[model samples]
Target chain A: MTVSDPTVGELSEGEILARILARLSPSRALLGPGDDAAVIAAPSGRFVATVDTLVHGPDFRLAWSNGFDLGWKAAAVNLADVAAMGARPTALLVALAMPDATRASFVEHIADGLRAACEALAPGCAVEGGDLTVSDTLVVAVTALGVLDAAAVTRSGARPGDIIAIAGDTGVAARGLDLLFSHFTDASGTPIAISPAALRSLSDEDGTALSRQLRPFPPVALGPAAASAGASAMMDVSDGLVLDASRMAVASTVTLDFDRQCVGDDPLSLSGGEDHALLATFPPSAVLPEGFRAVGAVRDVGAAPVTIDGEPYDGESGWDPYRDWDSARG
Target chain B: MTVSDPTVGELSEGEILARILARLSPSRALLGPGDDAAVIAAPSGRFVATVDTLVHGPDFRLAWSNGFDLGWKAAAVNLADVAAMGARPTALLVALAMPDATRASFVEHIADGLRAACEALAPGCAVEGGDLTVSDTLVVAVTALGVLDAAAVTRSGARPGDIIAIAGDTGVAARGLDLLFSHFTDASGTPIAISPAALRSLSDEDGTALSRQLRPFPPVALGPAAASAGASAMMDVSDGLVLDASRMAVASTVTLDFDRQCVGDDPLSLSGGEDHALLATFPPSAVLPEGFRAVGAVRDVGAAPVTIDGEPYDGESGWDPYRDWDSARG
Candidate 1:
C-alpha cells in the first residue's frame, strides 16, 4: 500500500513495527534492533552521548515540512551535537511518539529520511534502535552516541588571545526561514498551501534558502577535524552566533569580540538560529584548519561576555523554544 | 521557592534548567550534563543500549501517580531492558517534554525520582545527561546504557529440553494494577480523588499491590548472574507471562510448556504484565540459580509457541499499549 493509503491506528503495533524494521539497513553495531538492546563497539574507551527532542508544534510545523524533512532534520541536529564534541557519531537511538491517526506511510517516509540523512551527512553512523509510543502529537527524541578520535573539545577550554573560527555557512537557515514565512504565509501569519509547480518557480536563492531552513547541512566532519587540529573549544551554532559565543565566553571565563568585516554584513549572522555550523577557538599561533574562517578573537575576562566591532550589541540573542512564538517573531 | 510556588511558565528555560541541574548528584560519567554531550567510560569494548518512552495519557496519569512515581517508574522500566540482555546498567539519559504550564518543582521531583531509582534498583548507575523540551503534553524518554560482564544472552538461544526459570515475583504488578483501578475509580471507570486519610486506610496487601504497580523493582543483579551461570536465553517479563513466553518461543524456534503446579495457582501468574522479572532458560541438567524458580520447559518447535500444563491455553496474552484501553482491559 502507498503511504497515504492506511493510518497507523488501523494496524496492530506489531504490524507497523515489522514494516518499519524491514526498511532499516544493517548497522555497523555489534547488535542492532530486534533485540533487548543494541551493542556498539567503543574502542575509544569512552562514549560521547547527547539527546534532543523535537515536538510538532514548537519545533516544526507540518505545513512547513513533511515526515521526510522532519526525520532528516532530527538526525542532522542530534548528529551535530556529537560533532560539536569532536567525535564520530556511531549510533542513534530514537523514540517516536505520535497520534494514532498518523498515516503509516508517513512513518515509512520518516524511516527513509533517517536512512538518507545518515548516509549523506554521517556515513558511518547508523540508526541502531528505537522505541515507538502513542501520543496526542508527534514527538521525536533522539539519543546520539559517538566515539572520540581524541580528547573531547569542550566549551571551557578557550583562553584569552584564542582565535575564534567557524566552519560552514552562518545565517543561511534563518534566512531560509524568513523567506518561507514571507512567501508562503497569508497576511494573518498563517501558512498558505503552495503547489509543486509554484515551488518550482522560485528564484535560485529562495530555493536554496528554503532547503537550508528545511534540512540544515551541519558541518559534521569539521568537528573531528577541529579536534585533531588542536581546537581548544567547539560547539554547534544552533542558537545564533552572538548568544552561542557569549555561552562559550561565559564557560571559558573570557570575552569574545567579533570582527564585523569578518562576520559579513548580514545582521542575521548574529541572531539567526539553526545554522548548525562548527564554531571553535584555537591558540593565536595555531594555523586555522581547512574550511574554517576567522570570525572573532577571544579576549581577557571583561564586563560583558561578547561584543561585535569592539562594542556591546544589545539585541535578541537567539531562539528560545519556550518563549511565546508570536512575540519572539516580532 | 518551593516546588509548589512557581510554574515553569513563570521562569525562563535557563532558570528552570539551573534549578534542575543543582539537584542532580555527580555522575560516574567522564563528563556530565551542561555540555554539548556527556562522555561515559566504556572499558568493556562494547556498550549495550536501549530506549523507552512514557507518555502521559496511555502510559501514565497524573491523577494516579505523582512526579516522583513517574520518574521512578520510567527509570525502572528502561533499566529492566538492559537487565534482560544480561548487562549491568551504567548510565541513563533522559529527555523530558512537557507543557509550559507544568510546575518547576514537579520537574525537580522527577529528577529526584530518577536518582532514587538508580540508587535503589541498580546501584552505581548514574543519570549522565538529558534534554528538556516544550510539548503540549508531558513525555519522558529514557536511553539506558549497560556493560557486559560475560557473553551477552539473547532470546534466540533456548534449545529443546532447556528448563525455563524466573527471578522475582510473577503476578504482583498486575495485582497492584487491579487494586489501583478498583480503588481509584468509580463504577464507570472515571478516577475519584481520595484524601490522604483514605489512602492511609488501605490494607497492607492493597497498599503493597498499588506500590508495585506504580514502581516495579526488577531483578537487576540476577541478569549478570544468569549470564555467568550459562543461561541459554533470557528476557524481561514486561508483558504477561503467556505472551512474553510465546515471544521467546518464537525467537528460539521452540515451544515453552509450563507446569501448572510449578507456576502456582494464580491465573494472573500466566497473563499478568509489567512485572519486570527476569525469565531465562538453561540446559535441563543445569542446576537452578539461587534466586530463580523453575516454571516450565522448552519443547521442540510445535504448532503453537506456548502451552500451560501441556494444554493449549488461549486467553488474553497481555497488554498492548496501542490497543483500545476499555476493550483491551479484559
Candidate 2:
C-alpha cells in the first residue's frame, strides 16, 4: 500500500533532494540532473576515491548535533580518506535517507554543512552527484573523488630505521569530545554556570577540536611530498599515534617504535580524528619538511607487535568500530 | 547519549570498513582500506559515471516492490546514466541511509539486488564504496563509474544537418508503468490478475520495458562511434524525446525535426522516462550503426521548438518532479 506518509515520520530522501537540487547551483558542475550519470572533468588523470557512512545516534546526538555537522562530517570523513591517499579532493557525492517528516530546514542545513566542508578543504570541490532515498533509519553516506597531480603514495613502503613523523597536532580533538560530552551531560543534567567567557573559551576550544573531529585537515599535498622525498611508507594519523604507527609497521612488515615522550601535546594528535593529518616514514637521516614532527621510529618486524620505547605498553590502540562503540548509529 | 549495540551496526563506518577489508580479496582491488582513498586500476583511462536517487513510497510500494527490485533499481538507474554517457559501467558506489531499526537482511538483500543488476548489464561492476546513515527516511543514492576505450562523447558536440537517431525501443517502460497503475488503481480498486502466459509476454515486454525503466542499457559504444564518425552532438534520451531534443537543440543552437512515422511502435520514444538508449546526431553522410534507428533530422536554428512532422503537438513533454506528483508533504 502506498501510504504517502508512513507513520514513521517526514519527507522521503528523494523529496528533500528534489528541493535541494532546485536551489543548488551546479554551474561549476560539468553535468547535472536529468542524465544517467554526472560527468566531472578531472584534468588530472589520477583521481582518489573515498567513502564513509554515518549512522544515527552512535556517530551523532541529534539533540546536540545539527544537520550541518552531520553533512560536514559525512563529506569530511570521505575527503579525509582521499587526502590520506595524498590526493586533492575534486568532487563529492552524498547519499542521505530519512523518514518523510524530516524538516526541510534540516536538509538545507545539511547541504550548507557539506558546502562549508568542501570550501574549507578543497575550495572548488563541488557536490557532483549522489543518491537519496527513504528508509527506516537515518544514514548519511558520502563518497569523495580527488585528483593526484604528481603521484599516489601508499602505506606499504616504510623501510626499517625510518623516522616516523606527523603533520598537525594530536589528542585535542579527543579532549574536545570529552568536553562536548561533558557539556551534553551537564546540559542534560543540571544547568551549569556557563558564563559568556567560559562559553567563548569552550567555543574556541571546540572550534579547534570540532574541526579536527568534523573536518580533518588531511595532508593531501604532504602525501605526494613524502612520496617525492623518498618516504618509504605514509598514512594519515586517524586512530591514534601508537595505533596508526603499528598499522604502518604491519603494512610495511616492519616493527614501529613510538617515543611516548616525543608524542606532543597537540590535542589534534591525541584522540584526534578528522585532523586529516599525514603521517609518514622517512629515512632517519632525511630532513623533515615544515610541519613535520618526529614522533617515533620504524623498526624491524621481529617477535612482538608494536611497542612504545622498546616495551609493549598496555593501552588502547586506535578506534575500533566493533570493539570501541556500543552502536555506530549517529 | 550513545546507544551501544556492540553488534553489527555498532561499528563506525571506518571500523566496519577495516573488517570488510580483512575479508575481501585484496587482489581484486588494487588498493583497499586504511588509506585516504582506494585506487581502482581502470585498465583503461576512459570511465563512465552515472547517479540516481530512490525515495520511499512514491518510487516504490513496499508491499508490491521487494527489497530485490529496490536494490536492483538503485544500481540500474546509475548504470543507465553511465551508459547514457556512452561509457561501459565498471564499478559503483552505493550510499544508503535508513533508520536504526532497519533489519540487516534488508541491507544485505539490497546489496544482492545491486549484484543482480551488475550481472545483467556488465559483470564485475559491484558496490565499491558508499556511506550509510540513520535517517528518518530510507534513501538510496548510487554513483556508477564506467569505462570507454575510445573517445569520450558529450552532448555539446552535435552539429547542424546531422541525422538524429536512437538505439532500442522507447516509451514501453512508461506503458508498463501505466499497466502497473492500472493493476493497482491508487490502492482504491481491485488489483488486476496477471496471467502466466500473459505474464510471460508481459515479462518480455516488461523485461525490455523494465530494463528500460529499472535498468537502462545505454549504447555506450555508440558514443565514441558517433564521435569518431564526426557526430555534431550526443546525449542519452532521459527526459522524453521532445524535451531531451530541446536540450540538444538549445546546446547546439539548432532545431531538430522528427518524422513521427519514422519513429516505430516503441512507446519509449514518444513518452518514456528511463529507456536509456543513446541519442546522437551525426553528419548526413554518416552510416547508421546497428540497433540504431534514424528517427529524424537536425535542422538549423529556426523559430519553432523541437517538433514532430514540422508541428508541435500538445502532449506531456516529460516528467516534472514537482508537477508529476499528486501532492507534497512537509
The interface root-mean-square deviations, each candidate in sequence, come to 1.3, 5.0
lDDT of 1 by residue, A143-196 (tens): 999999699998999998899999987888999888777888879887666568
lDDT of each: 0.85, 0.63
Best by DockQ: 1
Error of 1 at B23 (Å): 2.2
Give model 1's docking category.
medium
User: By DockQ thresholds, what CAPRI class is model 2?
Assistant: acceptable
Q: DockQ of all candidates, in order? A: 0.74, 0.28
Model 2, range A281-324, lDDT digits (tens) per residue?
88877888776788788788865546667787455656654345
- Candidate 1, residue A288: CA error in Å? 3.3
Top lDDT: which candidate number? 1
